[model samples]
Target chain A: EAGVAQSPRYKIIEKRQSVAFWCNPISGHATLYWYQQILGQGPKLLIQFQNNGVVDDSQLPKDRFSAERLKGVDSTLKIQPAKLEDSAVYLCASSPSDWSEQYFGPGTRLTVT
Target chain B: AQTVTQSQPEMSVQEAETVTLSCTYDTSESNYYLFWYKQPPSRQMILVIRQEAYKQQNATENRFSVNFQKAAKSFSLKISDSQLGDTAMYFCAFVSNNNDMRFGAGTRLTVKP
Candidate 1:
């Protein structure tokens, strides 16, 4: 079976510029998540969606970051006015349900200059 | 808030030998999930193994096994007869049954032949 899919495996942007990342989760999976992994650090959850509705996004930076899972099959994460600290690997993952093992996609590595 | 820790930033082992990666987490929830993920040079996050918090027996998959100490909030991964292909960044993650997942800082493992 095909795993989760993401677009633009790598991206580079200047500080204060805007960047967006896309994710297409596995078929039949009900839970989708976005995470940020800084170099030499573990991933931190940005947002989570169950179908077309958000389940949790408490850790998301409301002032600069936003994400949406509009039809429940695909999702997008956007960061406006990117900063140097925002340079990291953005990962997308999906699971069959709320409490199950997750399947991850090849992350989008964003480098902010 | 749950937090996972990987005290070791890096580790090295000779090919065909064994190596263990340590992890500890802080959480009050009793029913949860723990996972180990491998990220190779390609930047794909692959699930290596997982264990359920309530399960007393440790989880094992092929040459990969976990030593889960629920009371101690410890979960470690043991790779047996390691191979060069096993070299990668390993992350420890926690997911409560409520679906709140958190991850550690990650440990980079190198296998030298």
Candidate 2:
């Protein structure tokens, strides 16, 4: 039942350069998320992990955004200096806990020009 | 601080007819949970139905259905018969019980065949 898995689906940087996104979840799942979909809007929760710690990131963007979920099954989301409103579509979800019902991945369309 | 409102940004069903997409949410936490995600165009993020706020029994799956009105907190989503892959971009989410998640600003359904 392979589901959540993301990486370089699409990306283009320039504004301040620096971008990174990657996720791999859905195998026992334990809650892991990182969303930010801004085309027409609808996804915005920048961080959340239940396995390698972090349960929430308070909308992240702590100056440059960051994320990690190492031992809890792949995860990574970074946006160093990118801007242009940080172009969007960087979803990555997984849940079998922390309330349940979530399974998404196939995003990573950052195009900050 | 949970807020998810999808004031129908777009809608147009014709395939087999039948469409209803609308959502309203602003939590005061009554044991939260409500979702209806579906973002096609290859962006993934699916899971078209979910509702559980004390569950007054309103959550279907087959042709997708949801009309949970927990005290008017509202939560609508009805897509029956409609097809053509049921167009996409329809989100309405909110999860709180301490998890605090939110998403909404979407509703671009168009399944006109």
TM for every model, in the order presented, reads 0.97, 0.36
Model 1, A1-113: lDDT tens digits are 99999989999999999999999999999999999988888888899999999999988999999999989999999999899999999999999988778899999999999
DockQ of the candidate models in sequence: 0.83, 0.30
Once fitted onto the true fold, the runs of candidate 1 whose alpha carbons sit more than 4 angstroms away are none
* Each model's iRMS: 0.9, 8.6
Candidate 2 global TM-score: 0.36
Q: Candidate 1, overall lDDT?
A: 0.93
Pairs of residues clashing in candidate 1: none
The digit string of per-residue lDDT tens for model 2 on B1-113 reads 67888887999989988999989988777888888888889989888788889879998999988888888898899999999998988888888768656788988999988
lDDT of 2 at A84: 98
